[model samples]
Target: MTTSFPDPAAFVGKVAFISGAASGIGAATAGRLARLGARLVLADRDAERLAAFAAQLATQDVLALNVDVTSMASVEQAIAAGIAHFGGLDLAVNSAGIDLPRCATAHYPAEDWDKVIAVNLTGVFNAVRNQIPAMLARGGGSIVNVSSIMGFRAFAGQPAYTAAKHGVIGLTKAAALDHAAQGVRINAVAPGFIETPLLAHLSEEKKQEAAMLHPVARLGQPDEITSVILFLLSDAASFVTGACYEVDGGYLAR
Candidate 1:
């Protein structure tokens, strides 16, 4: 259970349950945690991709579960699977979310708003509610929710997305307060524009425009967010809770 330089994050015997882990930030976080010696329980809706990812990391104590974060039943099933596979759950990353309907509040459709909220806000809630009990029973753990800069700031045409992200921060703080005393730390990461498969839907021009919006003059990578997440999940952040770490390349500053 030891590494060369004393991995403060020696999660070798620990279990990390991650939602939205089939790709993007979730996938990267899973890989990072695995490298740090954490047994992983990765959940996502994409069964095919999930299987492939699980296959690749199976040797590292990874179990893949197909889950729809919007569903309490699905979330619970995944949590149960994690406990069964890894014996108990020690940490969780609520990265399962969705984004669509890029329009102003006035033009945003009710259905689109509902869908976004269900997947982004409700999705995170389900993950947390399902995972916390196990973490509590184990005496201590960490929870990291993947929020976005829009959670605090605003873009021109993303009302539903912004609302859901803001809700995530509020939820994170409330949970942190509720569980910090129980040895469970809850926090959120608000990332700025990041280049991921999600951004692949945008045209070349749109992608560049989004990148330029960051003060860093470029978008973030999935790995960049992974670093912050790993730190928060590790013992290094034992004193940190209810905090919203901004991995936005100073986007909020501008």
Candidate 2:
């Protein structure tokens, strides 16, 4: 395969796997990749949603799996099955994540911390570890982990979410450096508060308040982040690895 990729992304015929494919950024990424002509392996804990969404794509080259990103076994099995279904793996986007309700670090329940870390941080680890070897075996490939503005910035009353997102950045860097030599390009995209289902728990007033935090005075959309992800996955970013692209609309700038 040629390292040369097109400007928008040369996804045609590429076998791409994505976690958290039921909704939000994961769903948006999956939809876009499908349109771009990539064979898709979509996974999410929500089996019904995953199947429904996968079918809506109207593409024959799709495999929907109910995967729990926190489990190494689940993630490993998903990867192996995807490769077997599609023949080989070429790229991946690990976007499966969750956020707990606000709670001070001192009062944050241990279980909540574990849950947040398990899905938001360890989840990425499970995917990356499995994705790397698959890609390496095929010569080289790309992986994009979704980090957050919270990865570098602080969010009060949300200790677990803050810590997990921060860990994602560190993991992305470490994994990328370890595999860049082997032709696996790993990177992260840190989006500002996005108007995804993850924020459905917040009140309208709270959502507005959250929007104001960005200099753009609005939240990001899944497509905004998805576009950057496509670029990073494409050979367009062949020289780029171990980097975190902040799509925060100036949240980090503040």
Best candidate per TM-score, number?
2
Give the poorly placed runs of model 2, Cα more than 4 Å off: 1-9
Model 2 Cα lDDT, one tens digit per residue, 1-254 = 44755444588889999999999999999999998899999999999988989989957999999999999999999999999999999999999999878988889899998999999999999999999999988999999999999999888898888888899999999998898789999999999999999999999999999999999999899999999999899987889999999999898886
Report how far off residue 253 is in candidate 2 (Å).
1.2
TM-score of 1: 0.95
Could you report the Cα RMSD, in angstroms, for every candidate shown? 2.5, 1.8
Instruction: Quote model 2's TM-score.
Output: 0.97
Off by over 4 Å in 1: 1-9
lDDT digits (tens) for residues 11-107 of candidate 1: 7778999998989899999887877788899999999998898787635688888899999999998899889877999989999888784788888
